[model samples]
Target: MEIYQAFLVALVACFGKFTGDIGYFMFDRPIVLVPLTGLMLGDLQQGLLLGAELELVFLGIVSIGGATPADVNMGSVLASAFAISMGAGTDVALALAFPIGVLLQMVKMLIYFFRATTMHKVEEYAEKAEFDKITFMHFGHCAIYVSVYGIIAFCSLVFGADAIRSIVEAIPQVVMDGLQATSNMLPAVGFALLLNMLWDKKLAILLLFGFVLSSYLQLPVLAVSIIALTIGLIMIAQDRSSSKTAVQTTGEINEEEDFFNA
Candidate 1:
């Protein structure tokens, strides 16, 4: 019954937007999707807890252009579902989910390749000036992509979780320890992704400030985020002020030139 529910949840999640590849991060947001999966399994609280941890780990996972970094949707759903069924806590579930998320990323890359094939048809419609056809083609491509996601999600819900639980249960203590070690390393992967996006020489000072506040002062993540936002606002305000002053100076110089000409 839970399996059936998971299938419905996956279907709604993937196809509700009428496009499956609705960009990985938005639909795959663990906070939103994990709770839904939990509700389906009749364990909403556990789902929320697991989802929160998974969210922290994958907070920096993003799709840039044609690249799908990792499949958070599959990871969160599978982890939450398995954990709930096995009565495991969020930490244990997260330990299991991180590696699965990395594997799912490869599946997403394959999906990207499949979607690319439809682009030629889209180009043909553009060349023919058939705007409606182009729209239809794009929609069709989205449908296909979503269908693939839905199918994979449904299969995992139906067949994979139980199999995974069996294998996990059979693993030696040392292997479980190894899994925990790998899980501990996953945050670094997420941080690396963030660094790739956010690393700028100009922003080095901001990063240092955040690190000091969090590490030395022991500030909460929320507090650090708020402080960072405030700093960003101040910087933006200064830039705007500088731009306004420059514009005013340029206008004054223009006026002086006109007077000299007159």
Candidate 2:
């Protein structure tokens, strides 16, 4: 692709990361953004397939306590673009995406660390009730986010793809195989992390139930979700019914005591 085209693609892709948390656009999701990146590169099918795979890889990665394992946005955009541009297969693309995700995560965290300084400015505004000034400070912070995530993505998509393709092409067979192997392991890692986060002794039965539905019965995810929701609603209704019964019983006991007193 031409330089301007790559830049545009990159700029749009950055929303998958930089501006992702800002609004309803939801460009940060791999399922949504990767395909768009692929469309920009004239290979929407490949992009969608790659996006699905990446989503699985990063599914367990969430920002708990204000830290994520990787930069989901930059990873999806750059990996899909670089892979499609080079005609690399899915495995290689996944391998490339993993490292880039971690790298970009570090970059983002560094920017965040520095951005914390601006909190003082926000505090100063709060003291005086200068709401407009505080809002402007927020805009300035967002501009910083755009500069870091968006500009970096634009540069990478426009200028780095060809070089990355060249380097990937030159990698030795053994190292390439290792990367492919690592790619295969990523999904399992993601799932395991998710399980660790969600696991609780009290809720173990729910996990087991889901496992049975998925592994033994081979139910579709939508079906499983519907069943789970139904169970939750039923439980809620039962709880409400029990509370009502207890209230009625108490009222009846009070009436009997009044009759005795009269």
Candidate 3:
């Protein structure tokens, strides 16, 4: 990649981190970042396709509390950069993204680890009523967190791109096929993970209905979405009617009880 292109990738990575700091607008997602990275690299179409595919793999990943998921932002940026700049395929990008994300997640933990160790300073500031210093540390931490990822992005693209391309060129056909197969299966895995988190007995019937519509009846996604929306509206209306009836019944009972007392 050219120096300016590499710088742009790093800049995009910085923006990805910035989004998370400022209320998580989801600009860091693979689907969003990859296209932006691709645009910077002059391969928007490939970036878009790869970004869509990568989104499936990372779809179910959510960082709850202190837990860190893979660094999708870093992985998507670098993988798309390598794939675009090196003229590699989507499979290569998919193969590259997950491991890279997983590996970089450790770096994220280290950042968190150091930040955690500094809580005492914040505590001391709080005890001393140094609110300004505490505020300064918060912004400083955000800047440092964002810059570290940006530097990683820039260096990885500039320094590591050639090495990765060379390795990709040397890999055997069988291994490549395996990687492609795995890539194909990853979306299902992502969906399964998401379902595991969201599963409820009440929603199982709806899930099956959508599955049958899409799988058996060959209904398009738009049709299924509209059907689901209709069902949801019906359910909402039923609940509202039930609530009104119960309220009216309760009011009648209260009035009858007061009449008897009088």
User: Could you say which candidate leads in TM-score?
Assistant: 3
User: TM-scores of the models, in the given order?
Assistant: 0.77, 0.77, 0.84
195-258: candidate 3 lDDT, tens digit per residue? 9999999999999999999999999979999999999999999999999999999999999999
Question: Which parts of model 2 are misplaced by more than 4 Å?
Answer: 23-27, 66-68, 201-262
Top candidate on lDDT is 3
Q: For candidate 2, lDDT tens digit of each residue in 1-262?
A: 6777687676666566555647746558787788888888788899888888787788787777756777776787788788888788667777677789899988888878888977998898999999999888777777787777777887887778778888788889898888778777887887888888877797789879988999999999899999999988998999999999999999999999999999
Each candidate: RMSD: 3.6, 4.0, 3.0
Residue 103, model 1: Cα distance from true site in angstroms: 5.8
Scored against the true structure, residue 196 in model 2 reaches a CA lDDT of: 89
| lDDT leaderboard ranking | 3, 2, 1
Candidate numbers, best TM-score first, in rank order:
3, 2, 1
Q: How many backbone clashes does candidate 3 have?
A: 0
Q: Which has the better TM-score: candidate 2, or candidate 3?
A: 3
lDDT of every predicted structure (CA atoms): 0.74, 0.80, 0.89
Model 1 lDDT per residue over 214-234, tens place: 999999999999998998899
